[model samples]
Target chain A: MVIAAIGIAAAAALWRRDGAPAVGAALYHAWELFLFIAPSLLAGLLLAAALRQLVSPGALARWMGAESGWFGLAVATLAGALTPGGPMAAFPLVLVLAGAGADRGALVAYILSWALNGFQKLLVYEMPLLGPDFAIMRTLVTLPMPMIAGYIARRLPIAWEPPK
Target chain B: MTGGQVFLAVIALVAFGFCLRRGPGSARRAVVDTGQGLWKILPIFAVALPMAAFLAELIPADAAVAWIGPESGVSGVVVASFAGGLMPGGPFVTFPLVLAFAKAGAGVPQMAALITGWSIFALHRIITWEYPILGWRFVAIRLIAAAPLPIVAGLLAEAVVAVLPIGLGRP
Candidate 1:
């Protein structure tokens, strides 16, 4: 609602300066963009939804908690990439997995992977808005990041003794 | 439609089919989830897409280039990374804002850094969820561990752009 209001105000300001035509031009461009992205957007949402249903959070958490070392990080990274929804979904699962004895390094890897490589975010938002080329390039660069970060976290001297 | 778009569609269909094979209830749930997601995003898209268009016009190309263009190099990536961390809202807001920056001629590496920063730093998420549920120790370690990623991603993007013929065209 706030964003829409701000957009309207901006449009009105543009209209006053550029005479209605500028606002019209912006609208036209927006509509063109909408048409361009609509198909992919729908498809992406479907993919996200299907993926979410296919993989249960319980199974994922169990998988993460059971692994350790480099392989654990890899599994956590994969789980993070596969996890669906936003913070609400991912964070709770993270908490559960952590409480269930998931490795600290693996958890870091999981969070990083969720942030950087989650297919839901990539497909539903990134590819549609940023285009596939940029998305692909970014994804390629990001693929190795979670494991690297997780490995570093494991080496970090600071211990995570959970609040009692 | 672009190949990317077609590829997305095919994947979506296959995934949906897989869910259906698993059970009708799961397929129904997927459909419901998709509808809910659409409902959530549509209004935001209505405003954001146009906002991106106007922003493309309003943002000075020279400023964008000076701040985060290909010529701006490592410093540009650093600046973009911080800016991205500060950007409020979810993917719906962030991606459109990135689109505006891209249209205004921001560098590919800079944008890559920006997105990475947004994803990892995620101050809002950390404060809201991570701190409360995971405790301060966990948050600190996560932040420290992931600190270098955005810069790395930016440099990697720059290298890729140099090697590849393909470009990140303005959407």
Candidate 2:
């Protein structure tokens, strides 16, 4: 609602001089971007749906464990890889997973990866925003972020459960 | 089937799956219920799609590039990542500004770093959305946990490009 109001203000400001055309132009531009990512977003929705049904959070946490010592971090990174939303989108899910007994390290990892390095974020958002080489390189660089996040969470004072 | 056809089929299947999940109702009732849920959101999507396009058009790409492009280097990456912390809006809002940067001579590494930073490091979002809902301790821990990840992402990308053979110029 607040966001819509702001958009209306912007559109209205632009409208003072020429209302009809400004809205049309803005609408057209929005359409183009939507057209670009709709396929990917729809697919992301489907995959999310699949995940909701197919895997329990505990099972997801367990499968994500790659190294015995670094298990939490690895699992988090893997979780990060598949998750498709930006940070805001990823956080609640991270909390839910943690609530369900996912390791804190993994939760941090998943959160980092959820926005910075997910397959969907990379493929859909990054590729277009930064171009292929840029997107590809960034993904490569950030690959360790979630793992490192997990590692730090494991070592640091942060608690896995929400701070009461 | 072609990927397109397969995708269409999947869409249909998802709808059917949704119907199955709805329970012992008539097929007509199930379809109506499902349609109503979907119908509610369609107009909002219809409106948002273009507004983003205008924002994309309004923001000048060259300026964004100048501020956070490859020329900025590691410091640039750190700045970009943290600066990204203050932005509001979705990936849709975020990507266009960064895309503008990439088009204007930003390095691949830096470009990647900035985008990653922008998406995840948003503090406004953390405080506004996550904190209020989750509480002080949870929010603080989450934010504290958040800081180092983008840096790690930047450094890791650098290391991978250095150690692994990751370029495309054949001998």
Q: Against the true structure, whose TM-score is highest?
A: 1
Residue B28's lDDT in candidate 2 = 49
> Residue B170 lDDT in model 2?
9
Candidate 2 lDDT tens digits, B1-171: 224324533754675566457553533454554345345434555544444444444455565556655456677667766766666776655665454344444444454555666656666666666667556655565556667656666656666656643321100
lDDT of 2: 0.56
Interface Cα RMSD per model, in Å? Answer: 1.8, 7.3
Report candidate 1's interface RMSD in Å.
Answer: 1.8
For residue B93, model 1's alpha carbon misses the true position, in angstroms, by 1.0
Model 2 chain A weakest 10-residue run by lDDT: A49-58
Worst 10 residues of 1 chain B by lDDT: B162-171
Which parts of model 1 have CA positions greater than 4 angstroms off?
A63-67, B169-171
Candidate 1: the clashing residue pairs are: none
**Candidate 2, residues A62-145: lDDT per residue as tens digits?**
544324346667766776677644555566676667665666566667766776767655544444333344455666666776
